[model samples]
Target: MTKPHRHASHPKLVARLKRAEGHLRSVVEMIEAERPCLEVATQLQAVESAIRNAKQALIHDHLDHCLDADSSEHDRAELKAITRFL
Candidate 1:
């Protein structure tokens, strides 16, 4: 099989995801420490937003840079699949 195509934005996407991961860890810590519900919820919301943004950015990057005239039926199907997250 061919290697997966790498996009110019992959590094930025990875960094975005890492930041989300850090936020998630903080959320877990807050929950463990029995922080106020509102505070925990706010942090959780931030984590969710970070993850969602990263996903959307990655999807957009893929759609912009991965597809081409030579793309196959499977690539089209994959694009449709990824959009379900949004």
Candidate 2:
């Protein structure tokens, strides 16, 4: 049987996605407004940080659920590989 994919339970994941969406919209606005390169770069960095936070939240959930539920040696190795990214 195939295992179910687990998702992060934190509200922060939703907030991160919303923030990214807003950031993208802001980027578009910046381009339209002819904003400075430095200002745009700052906004891009904020979006990158938000995405990283989302990734960490997902990794936390995976470690708690999928990693904990698996019993096989290969699963252990895969879990280690994934957790190493965190």
Tell me the number of clashing residue pairs for each predicted model.
Answer: 0, 0
lDDT for each of the candidates?
0.85, 0.79
Query: Which lDDT tens digits does candidate 1 get at residues 1-53?
Result: 04667788989889989998998998899999999999999999998898888
- Badly placed stretches (over 4 Å) of model 2 are 6-12
Looking at candidate 2, the ten consecutive residues that score lowest on lDDT are 1-10
Off by over 4 Å in 1: none
Backbone clashes in candidate 2 total 0
Clashing residue pairs for model 2: none
lDDT of 2: 0.79
Global fold similarity of model 1 (TM-score)? 0.87
Which pairs of residues collide in candidate 1? none
Over 5-75, each residue of candidate 2 has an lDDT whose tens digit, in order, gives 53647676787788798988998899789999899989888888888888888877767777555468888
Q: What is the TM-score of each candidate against the true structure?
A: 0.87, 0.72
User: How accurate locally is residue 11 in candidate 1, as Cα lDDT from 0 to 100?
Assistant: 91
User: Model 2 residue 28 lDDT?
Assistant: 80
Candidate 1 whole-model C-alpha lDDT, 0 to 1: 0.85
